[model samples]
Target: MPLSGDLTGDGRISPMRSTAVGIRSTRNPRLEVPLGPFRPPGLSLTRGRAGFGSLVLIGALALSMSPAIPATTVRDQEVAGVATTGGEDPGIVGDSGGYATAVAQAHPHPNPIGRTDPGGVAARAVVPAVVPVVFGPRTDETTLRRVRTIRGQIRPKSVVASGAGLVIADNMMYRHSVTIYDTSGALIRTVKDRVTLAALGWPDFPTPVSGAPVEAAMSPDGATAYVTNYSMYGKGFARPGWDLATPKDRVDDSFVYRIDLASGTITGAARVGAVPKFIAASPDGRWIIVANWASWDLSVVDVATFREVRRIPVGPEPRGIAFLPDSRAAYVTTQYHDARRGYPAELYRLDVGDWTLEPIRTDLGHFPRHIVLDADGRYLYASMTGDVTVIKLDTTTGKIVASVRTGAAPRTIALSDDGLSLYVVNYDDDTLVKVGTADMRVLQRLATGHHPVGVTFEPSTRTVWVACYSGTLMLFHEEG
Candidate 1:
């Protein structure tokens, strides 16, 4: 059958026909994806009587159709600037100046404080798929808290918390991935949705077949979660955080999966620019900005329509993303480690009002990873890798005002609700450190699981949740 229509709903995957038998490997991570038009080479068209007369289209090509389930058709809409497929917008409450009002509302369901993962999944949790190894040495904090570790896959990369206390962690290697927890440092549910897809008519859909979920952001009202598939589209599995894509080189164009937090269903998927890393929803909840690593740009999506409205160009390998409370401008970290691009990662301010990309003043050996702004949005906090310091940047000056020493490779940093405390996740040392924003002194040194990549402060429980690549979700709470 010839491939026609959008395989994953991005015009990039075009239709094709072949006369010779061509077998393409489904697991080839190095598949050559042309930037010019991309046509699926999955079909093997051979010399036969019906070859010329045939027009084969795999309606379920990448959708992973299940033979037992009945088929359903969903029309595509011309939304924002791009097209959206899958299903209708049921979460949208009302439209105000093109913004989806319902989507911006927070989830009303509250989280349990101090308690952990759903229904004691920790004690009865299934054995690790692989022999369990230590992510870090067990310290007093680990022994004290009992560290509610949600183990499933090997590499749990990032975690995002919803307003209602829903914690979702990104699993890099396994299928039926994405472990979930509540506000109490307890496992709530596994994001693995096999039945939902089949019910939606895609029964046999294979899991990703390439990419995996890395970073996610929840809508203010807490109804939806938008997840970025780190390198899912073209050779995504080969790289975890960033995927390389150029207009003429490999396609590497990525996708963001829109999931219903309550339903455990993937409602829709939007195609963004190549190798999308960090995703952030504007405070106003009208727009979602994604930092594309390879294309050296940002895909700005309208929340109401879930479509890419603008692709803002920035520096190479942009990772961390932070939106101002007013949603006027955002601070982003452009990693300095790309050898092809050369030295000193830059920090740029993207003005949402005019869509202007301006770089902050700084130079030399400053490798930035994660960025978090103060509650008032007047100040900014960033974690720099090479220097191993959390540098405070004044919004007005755009220069580092203060710096504090910490463990190696600080990746994810979160600020307390009142902006009094800051939490930094050191990937190399596997420690979660809390620092006072005022004095910039090390407040707490809590050990974490292996390759601690994601950290978030939960207001409901007043606890901090950490997602470890060693397949553990470690939770820390302060005692009175």
Candidate 2:
């Protein structure tokens, strides 16, 4: 196997110290054609220098006497040294006598040693009179070397870092209280909910909605943290929310509790929409895009004003929202619910400038949930319930060039700092797959907690953070 070498950020090949050599032989000299078509009369060359000296003296006299036999070719009888290896081409070169014999006897066959090349028995015994060691200072030595390290601390199933510190949503309690931990997962403050639906404005509610905050996303300036409350208001006898006495009262409106990070207190709460699942920010950090799964609408909120700017109607069950850089447009995914209904889902291009919504392309696959764009803003990736699809989007034309498959049930995706590979969370398989963006191949798979949902890469930490549906947060380190 070819050992892996550390490459630069630009993907340049940097040669490392190797111990293996690759060899190839040149064509034999016996097959060479004679210098001339015929030999000249009275002209003879000897095998060695001693024989050649006497022959050269005789040949000079014969050349004067023999006018009929034209001198076909002149042979140089001096033994010359030839470099059979090393230098530019690492091939044969003719030079002086003793060196030529030594090189010819030592290297009778082809031998080429690279940095990794293993020195043979003859090469070990014979040393060059003037050994040349080529050395150059490492290019870009100022740049820090990236090394992969194992995460010393085991991540919880789900971590929501809010104003109240880090909260771990654990399934151990079943319809439970949030586990409040410090930055290091040590228990800090646990807040249990005793208030009913009426306290939060809703009245005549039968089954009270429990608090299960799955993921928490902070505002760009780090002032507010929006904690997504993923709770169902029903019992186990039927499907979730099916046993409700009143349908409207039974509907669970997921809340995004806006907590002031600096104050460590809940400042306000916004009723975004039903199943207000994942949250994303606009390029300018002026708007927050929330994906409402049940309503199939993207709720755009103006950050400064803290009000609903516009509700862009998308496809069925929009789960992921990604804003394109340098533009007022955003892309949201409509996850497929039923294949028989031909609801293969699409990416809705929401124009924030005009508050208009249009379907960009609908041909990706079933249940396209999570979406992310490349740093160059050329390609857009949608992770579906079946397979992740890479759609080459022409930003000007608003059209898709091609769509390629990625991984099984890809829920969330994040790009590396260098943008060479994409990290995807496979929710169903509970694994994270690293995919190469250039060739779109699965590079590596990492075991993660159950039902990983939100995926984000932190450049400063060089760690991939994953939020899980099973109430866990996983931190994966990049492999060198």
Candidate 3:
């Protein structure tokens, strides 16, 4: 059959041919033939009839059958062919089965990504990969907390009984002395120089010497006072009881005299280390420990025999000695030195039971002048050249937990009876500071004279005593 619709050789279709193709299928033709536009060159009729009469006869027959064709029938048939073929909707043919299967197979629960699928079958969630964080296990806090909670159990509320006395060493005009004040801040008696000189076997000197009483110690019962006399010889054969030097008149030996507290009489005298800076008795009052500033050794004396026992070798410029509560250990503080030369000063813990000394591994900065321990023994407080260091000591582990800073040039520290407060003597500022043990907070500051050096608290009197280098002792109490 001829192609339907506009099949003419020219661009335009005649109205007659358009109508013929539109109605060709509805009509009847005398012969089976083609209709619409004529074929192009090199075409022939299906039935070979070579004349125009035959061509006209075929045209008439196609016109008679034109009613059988419908308008735009060829376009409809082309669309139907494409639909039945695979060309149209290729994506649907490729993915439809797999997509349907996936939708049917999804879980009906929450997914690991914390999300839900479109049909609410699964939730999307994320599971983290495993990772471990390791740390050094420490029990310092538990130990400190336990110590603080039990501090008051063994500490005494106050000193019930107290004894007072004094020891004096003579100077040129005025006798330098220290009076042991009772809890009431009252001087019990005056200890003067004549008694001290007589006790030291220095009988008669026409000219008075320019020396003073440097330090003193009292017996446990307060019955006797031992005073150290600092004296120097200037000219001629040195007087009795004073060492005569070769050229510079430096006294080779110093005297420690014992005095009767009640009678004010000299009882005993012995030569001790030169420039004795401090004197302390053993816990049982059987031995006396003295730190000689000019010497690099400590002198130990048998209290009963009044004789030297042993001189323990220590660091350079050792100044302070503190015996542990059990009396088994004594801690000494030394002046700072160049560690490169093996002279670095440190805090030495001396095993009194064996006389063995070991340096405490701690960072005390430089110039640890004095050292003290807290009531519970959890901490060591050291007064260095410029600050006070509160070292949290682990006695079992032998490590330091923390080192806290304090005022400038702290010389000494005295812990209160309650163990909650610490009083520091700042030599540079001449001030006494009360610090809280728990939080390391400064509670109070009391001004004093120039160069406050030593600090001690008398529990019976509830007063804090400060030894001023400016020639006076200051007493501080709550100003109510």
lDDT of the structure predicted as candidate 3: 0.42
Which structure among the candidates has the greatest TM-score? 1
Per-model TM against the reference? 0.64, 0.54, 0.56
Candidate 1 vs 3: which has more TM-score:
1
What lDDT does the true structure give each of the candidates? 0.53, 0.43, 0.42
Candidate 3 lDDT by residue in tens digits, 1-480: 121122233212222332122211211111101111211000000111122122211100121111111111111111111011222221111111222122112211111232222111112122211111111111111111000000100111011111221212221112334333233222333444444343345554334333335555545433455555544333322631221111123334555656554445556655566555556554445666776554555777666656567777564555667665555777766553323323333556677756766655324445566666654345666666544454444454445555556666776676654456677777667687777766666777667666666666533222455655544455553221
Better of 2 and 3 by TM-score: 3
Q: Give the worst 10-residue stretch by lDDT in candidate 1.
A: 41-50
The local lDDT score (0 to 100) that residue 318 gets in candidate 3 is: 59
lDDT of 1 by residue, 1-480 (tens): 121221122111112321121122112232212212222200000001111123311110111111211001101221231111223221111111211111112112332233222221112221111111111211212211322444544346677766454667776434435656544333445564222222323334333444467678766544467787655532223432333344345445666777766545576666687767679877666778898866767899877666788887665567778887667888776654222232112566779967876545324125666788875667778887655788787777555667788788787888754356778888778898888777787877888876677887654333467877666777664433
What is the lDDT, from 0 to 100, of the residue 126 in candidate 1?
19
Candidate 2 at residue 9, lDDT?
A: 34
Question: Which is better, 1 or 2, measured by lDDT?
Answer: 1
Evaluate model 2: give its lDDT: 0.43
How many angstroms is residue 219 displaced in model 3 relative to the true structure, after the best TM-score fit? 3.1
